[model samples]
Each structure stands twice: as structure tokens, then as C-alpha cells.
Target: MENKLNDQKISSTIETEVLVVGAGNAGMMAAAAAAEKGAQVMIIEKEDSINLLRLGLAGVGTNAQKRAGMTIDKYELVEYLAAFAQHNVDEGLIYHWANNSAEAVNWVEDNILKPHGAHLRAEPDSLVTSSAYQGFSTENDPTIDDETFVSYGTWFQEKIAALGVNLSFKMALVKIIKEGNVAVAAIVKNISSGELIKINVSKGIILCTGGYSANEELLKKWNPLALKKNVYNDSPRNNGAGIVSALDIGAIKDEEPAECIFDRGLVPVGKKTEEMYVQTATYEDWLWLGSHPLLKVNLRGERFANESVPYQFTVNAASKQPGYLYAMIWDDNFDEYAKQFHTLGCARVGFPGYMANAKKLREDTQRYVDKGLVVQADSIEELAEKLQLPAENLKKTVLRNNELVKMNIDKDFGKEAYRLTPINKKPYYGCILGGRILCTSDGLRVNKKMEVLDANYEPIHNLYAAGNDSGGFFFGSYPDRVPGLAASHAQTFGRLAGQSAAK
Candidate 1:
């Protein structure tokens, strides 16, 4: 493969069998898989290091699941995921993840994690056999402390390096140079030196450049609703470089607006949701109790939707409210009520089937209290006053909610009986909540083989994409009911793309 540079000021030219953009979880896995196949691979990243957040890696029929005495029907799981996306997603891609994810996860365990004195474990109490949405199990998480999750990424980085994968940091992808329809080279900018480097690839180029959560321009164009309804809480470096570069060369992408929105963005009292943006340092700022099925009211102090639903559903309900914000009201017995709520996903800390971080949850809530993000008062009226909501409406709403709790049946909204905890306890707490943009779910369309496709649904030669940069697996909204589905999809398709590209 050859391409003309066309009088461009190129500082250096390099050649490789496979070129991978982004050194995230997906990119690292791609580089490692290609190098393991004896292909010279170069992985580049704009940031200095990989993201250390330990995302839940969900997979079915893995060694960890077998050790936990768990079994899941892959067909049922795929169907459930398809329905979850309203059948707008590609079933082929979902089935691909369901079938190959186990092997990919086991490969990680054997080659990367276990070698570093770490292993994968199922979340306690994560398996759910009977439910409308069945086959729910804890994602395979590394057996490491939540604080030291960075070690997992570091270990994998070292393993890939030992496999002869070239890793470059501070290298930003500018565009893909294509000869007719085949991607042959990529022009990248050195972040530190402002130098352009062209890398010619003979085999393939894999893009795993994450999502456009931080790119305000892209959000305005593709997913403006997310911008208007949620606070930006993702990495600033993830600005849709890979998706844009691929689109520049006529790659097909999801036309619908989709995102991984969570209902935990804390809007301080008297502040609007639109005023809050780009809260990346949000560890201590997290409101774990916000996920609880507490009595939520709009700025007008009226209960809107059933609080027992998924996180994004709450955000969607709130988006219709006055300021795209809602207030979560809880009593002193929040700890007891939270346990009964049985929230899933990252919010399920201190509970079985997730991390045992009850202590951290308490500390985070206290920090929010200290910062006045969460207002505390002795009565509902006082709490309403502090939150700047109508006191009478809040008191009436609280009284109605307490009545529903006593009846063990939600008259207005069909909240579960167990989740109908009363808010009559003294020392009430409240916080205005909004949506938090976790990641943009829409991106370049790819097939089951992870090959980037053209507008006509044909494969773009020598081009592949994984992670948030690749789509056809998500639409409508993210299926948070299935924990770690996003990360597992990234790892699974990432490895597949690397192996396919190497060949």
C-alpha cells in the first residue's frame, strides 16, 4: 500500500503492519492481539497515560462465571440486548459480543491479569435467575482494590510492551489517508512538538478513540439533547477524533442520537443544570445515594415518575421537568432504604454483586453535605426552603409519599413495594439532580467482524473500529440493566478487530 503525502510538512514517516489509534482498553487489547499474531503494531494516544477507571467487564460463560457456578443462555441474552435497544441496534454485533466475549475475558485473565497476581471475580449476588430481564450477573472485575485500579491498566500495558507492541503517547490522530477506498496511512500530530508524522500501514488501521462526550461541537451536532439535559463528566481528550476522521473518509455511522447517560449529575441548590459542565474529577463528588429510589420532585416540588426505574430513565423523566433537573428527597433512614432499593451498576457499592465500598460511599455523601450540594434540614419544609422549592408542595408530596409507603403500593407511580420507603424520618436531605454524560453511544457503524463499513454497508478496506468509536451495538439508550456491557463490548470487539486486521 502506498499514498502520496502531497507537499505536506511531514516531520517523520513510519511504516507498520497494523496501526492503532487510542491506547485505551480497546486499543491496548488490539495492539496486543496484533503483536501476538506476529504483526508489527504501533499504538498511539493523545494523552500521556491510559484511563485508570476500572469499568465493569461483563461476559457470559467465562471461567469466572464457571467458578461462580453461573450459566447464561447466549441466545436469550442477545435477544434481551436487542429489545433493550428497541431493535434499533445490529443483532449481529450483539450476538458477536455474546459469543466471543467469554473467550476474550478469559484471555485477559490468563495472559494479563493472572500473570500480575490478579484475577477476575464475579460480583457477589450479581446473578439473577428470575426477572423480566433475566440472566443478570455481576461483571468480571479485577481482584484488586478500587483505589489501585490503575495497576490493572499498567500491568496490561507492560504485557503488551513485552509482546513487542510499540506504544506512543502524546500523538493525536489528525486524519486517515485513503488510496481510493482503502485506508493506507494516517497523519498524526505530535502534541508536544506540533510535528506531523505519517504512518503507512500495510495490513490495517484500528480506531478505538473512545467517544465524543467532551467534544461540545460534536455534541451540538449529533447529540444536542445530551448537552441540554446532562452535565459533561467524561475525559476532555475524548473529542471524537477517530469518528470524525472516519467520517471524513465516508464511513457509515449511526444516524440516531444515542448516549450513555446516567442520572447522578449533582446540581447545587439554586443552580440550573445547564450551568454545570465538564465535571471529570467527580470521584468524591459522586452522590451514591442518588441512585436510591428516593422520592424525586421537580423544581415545582411535584413527584413526576417512578423512581425505581433505571438511572437514565430518571434522567429522561427529569429532562421533561422545569429546568431539566429534579430534587432527590430522603430521610435519615437512607442507608436502610438504599439497601432495599438494590440499585445496580456502579452505584451498587457496599452491596453484594459490586465493590465493597460502603465506607467510600459514606465519605462521598459527607463531602457533598459539607459542600452544600446535599442540603440537610430538620423538616421537609426546611429542606424545601433550602432547596428553593415550594415548601407546601414539598410537604404535600412528602405526605403523599408517606401514605404510599404505609399502603405498600404506589398509587401515582407503581414503585416496588420494597422500594416504597417513607420520607417521614427527621433530618431530611435533598439535592438537585441532572444527567451525567458517561459516553456517546453513537459512532461509526461496524459489522460483527468489527470492520468499518461504508454508507452502502460494504466494508472499508483495511479499516476497523472498536469501543465507542464503533457503533451498531447501541441505540435508543444504554442498557444499564446489564452491568459492564459497554466495557466487555469494547474488549471483545477490540481483540477481534486486532486479530482480523493482523490477518
Candidate 2:
């Protein structure tokens, strides 16, 4: 521990057994795990307060899963994950996550969540209706108790506070100092004061600084398609400073960087915009893809994909469209259908706060329409004109969709028979949808032990990566349907990395 001050650059040095960057779920969990082992731990977070943008963890065969009668076929789970990543992820790392997720969930459940008056809720019954994975929730189960569901980040913050872990918020990692091939220290900036502090970790520095969704440069270099399609400024805190520092220290990169592609409505890029998305029964409720059976047309007014597929696939297809925009064409039966299916909200079914309130959502969307951010017309052709699309193509697309409805089969896009509702009613409605990136998946390459590896496949001594900051965990695209995969991997590996770094 050393401190040196100057007029322009006041420098200080602090030594700890474990240094965790970014106070998100991974960083917090890692810090707590290290402190539990009696290691002096320090966490530096960029935000004034921690974020819970995406909460929940994905685990298999936990006590909650067992209690809920959810049986996890280990072999099947591995196969499914492989298929999801198209066999591009690190096989050993994926297996490690699959095998240890149960214990990790239970561990946190006992130490962190339970103390905060929260319990892990594994509703395997959710799997019967959706292909999305069923993981554990640390939030209160309204079915069992009255305490509302709080995010695992909330629980982690609580536990870390109780453990007296040293945390400095608004302190951003600026650089990593390497002595020969080994990482020796880190330079962090006091965001408000513009001062720098040098931290020397005798044990290790765990990089849990999250993904690069906010960095346009990384988005362009790694995933250009996402840069064009993403509508919102999500994950603004994760600017890839950690990954850059690791790269500067000779860390390797994943072959295929991934991203969480989400279904987003039209939002102006450079304007102070109100809420542009509406929770309609058509898309927000079921699998966050929108209520099923809506006619999906590209900018040219042509059917593009199987609307019945998972929303991620839909986002992928929609991203290639002109301006990364697509029209979800539907008729007056939307309210009726949404009510029948119980997806009447504007956001994800279980997630009420991510554009949460239905009344507010409707009101905001209507405001956008009044301002011409959304288009509403009495007829399909007029609607197409307002969207600057070909009227005949739009009309033909609708007529063909109606024919499929009559036939009760989607021969073109393989849409299911039940979703073949004709768009024949008057006062047709359409919203221009844009793809959005939840987080970037390209991170420093790490092995099963959560060790950051160099280009030659050797561990960068005393350096580790976890959560969205670690690579080889995903490829191509994010699997949101695999409920809790992000959170589970973060906490599970964060725990493992913490223990490993402490040792």
C-alpha cells in the first residue's frame, strides 16, 4: 500500500489479496467469495450505484429445482447448450457450468439470497409452455410469500455490505500493468475527480466489468450487424475497458463474439425520445418475441421469416432488413388474442419493470404515434405509404397472409397453423421494429477454471474473467430463452474464480 500525490496526477497504491473490477453480479459474488476465504478484497465499480438491468441465474438440479420436480438431464443439458452455441463455445467450460450450476445456485441461495428474505424459485412448469430454460430466481415468489422478487444484484450488494468488502463506486479501470508476462497491478480512475489509483494484487485481479454494448468501436470491430440493428443505448456502463486492458496485456479473443439480440420497436437514434415500445399482447408477453401469429414484413412489405420462431431468431432475420426495421402487421383482433393468451402486458411476462407499466406503455406509444414515430392507418396501402414502403407489395403481402390463414398453414415461412390469423379487419396497425443489443459477448478468452489465457493457451497468471466479460462461453448470438444463463454463469464462475484467485 503506497500513496504519492502531484498537482496534476495524484497517485496512490493499495495492495489486496483479490481485486475485483465492476460491482455487478459477477464482481460482487467474486468479492464476497474471496472475503469468505479471509482474503482482503477490493471492488471498483464505474456506476454510482450497481445495476440490475438483467437479473436471475440459470442453474440445473438445484434444491429448488428438485423441490419443484424439475429434473435436469445432464447429458441433454450439455447437448442443448452445444446446439445453442452451434458447438463453438469452449466445451470444457460449458460442461463445468452445467455440472456446478446447481451447487452455485444453492450456495448463493443459502448465503446471499436467504439472508435478504429472498428464496430461489425454480418453476420447471414454465418449460412445458416455452422452450426457454427454467432456472432459479432469487426474488420473492408471490405464490409462496409476499416479498416481491428482488434481483440477485440486490442480494449480492446486501451480502457484500454485510461482509464489509471494500467497494469504491464511480471508480473505472483505466489500465493494467504487466511485468513481463504476468499482470502486476491495475490503474483505476476516480471518474469525478480525474485522479488515478494503482492497485497491486498479490493473488489475482478478476475482471467482471461486463460486456461492450456501449462501445461503438468494439461493436463495429466485433459485431457490425449488431451496431446497425441495435436501437437502444442499453448497458451504457459496460464500455469494454476491462477487455481492452486485458488485450493490452496479451489476452486472446474469442473466435465468434456474441450478443443478446432483442426485439425492439422503432426509436429515433439522435433525439430525446419518449418510450417508443408498447407492451402489446402480440409481442411482449410470449417469450419476449411479441404475441405470436403477427404478420412480419420487411421494409419492402414482404414476409421474411417464421414469426412463430424464438424472438432471437426473429431479431437476427429482422436485422438484415433495410434500416434494420420490420413491420409487425396485425388487425383488430390483437387485444382479443392477447387477452385470451394472458400476454396483455407490453414487456416480458415475468419482467414487469423493463418498460413495465402497461398503461404508461400504451400512453407513451400513442404519444409516439401522434408524433409520427409510429404509423397507424385505416388501410394497408395507406399504412405502407406512411412507412415509405411499396403499397402494392404491402397489399400483396397482406393478401397472401390472408390466404395462408384460409389454408391454416404458413407454407412460406413455416409458421404454425394456430398462428395463421388473417389480417383482414379494418383499422390495421403496424409498428416499425428495430433490433437491439442487450450486451456484447466477445471477451478475453478464458478456460474452465475461469483463468484468462494468452494466445498460446497459457493462463495469464493472477488474471481471470467472468460474466459477460469472459469469452468462449457463447457464440453467434445470445440465448435469452435459456433462462438465467448469463446470471448463472456470472455468479457460478464468479464464485469459482474468486476461490481460485484467493488460493
Clashes of each: 1, 6
Estimated TM-score for each candidate: 0.95, 0.86
Write candidate 2's Cα lDDT for 1-503 as tens digits.
12223213546778887899988767877888888888889999987987644445578778777777667677776777778888898878888988888877788778866776667666443322234323223221212242234555656677787787898898999888777777878888999988888888898899999888877788778876776665554577778988988998899878677887666545432221123322232233122324344788887889898775545577788766665667777776654443223221123333322333344345545665676656678998888877777899999999999998798777887765665677777677676666656678778899877889998999999899998889888888766556667777887888888888888
lDDT agreement with native, every candidate: 0.82, 0.70
Candidate 2 backbone collisions, by pair:
58-484, 279-346, 282-290, 282-291, 283-290, 283-291
Best candidate, TM-score:
1
User: Per-residue lDDT for 154 in model 1?
Assistant: 78
RMSD of each: 2.4, 5.0
Which residue ranges in model 1 land beyond 4 Å of their true spot?
A: 1-7, 127-135, 144-151, 279-284, 351-360
